[model samples]
Target: MNDKKKKSDTNSSAENVEQHLQELEKADYERLYYSQEQTFSADELARSINEQRLTELMAKSDEFLKSLNSELEDFDD
Candidate 1:
């Protein structure tokens, strides 16, 4: 009888754990779905701004290098 009781208790505990895990998974799925829906446009805007800034920096760097090359050529002469 004692052994049977222990077995029953273990099975009950396992079922409870399984139920909790399922709940957590459901919550996670819902959270991810909503978060993506909310952030998609904001994410795109952020990416566009970052790309524009990168392009501007590249242009400035190229101009600086060209000017430095000209200065070096003057020094060589």
Candidate 2:
């Protein structure tokens, strides 16, 4: 009977440890997920800003090209 009691106690202790480890793993996973999500959001914002800047640059380039073409025509005549 004493041996049986000892076995039961050991099993219970093992189960408790396993449960605690699972909980810790879950918490770690949640933290990592949120961290990655925030990083992705920041990357998206940066990409958007860069796209806007490129668009503005393209517009300015078009205007400059048009002016240069006009000057070239005037010089030819």
Please write out the lDDT profile of model 2 over residues 1-77, one tens digit for every residue: 99988877778777978989999999999999988876456778787677877899999999999999999999999
Query: With candidate 2 superimposed using the best TM-score fit, by how many Å does residue 62's alpha carbon deviate from the native?
Result: 0.2
What C-alpha lDDT, on a 0 to 100 scale, does residue 49 get in candidate 1?
Answer: 79
For each candidate, give its TM-score against the true structure. 0.39, 0.38
Q: What is candidate 1's lDDT per residue for 1-77, written digit by digit as tens?
A: 99988877778777978989999999999999998887457778787677877899999999999999999999999
Q: How accurate is candidate 2 locally (lDDT)?
A: 0.89
Error of 2 at 24 (Å): 44
Residue pairs of candidate 2 with colliding backbone atoms: none
TM-score of 1: 0.39
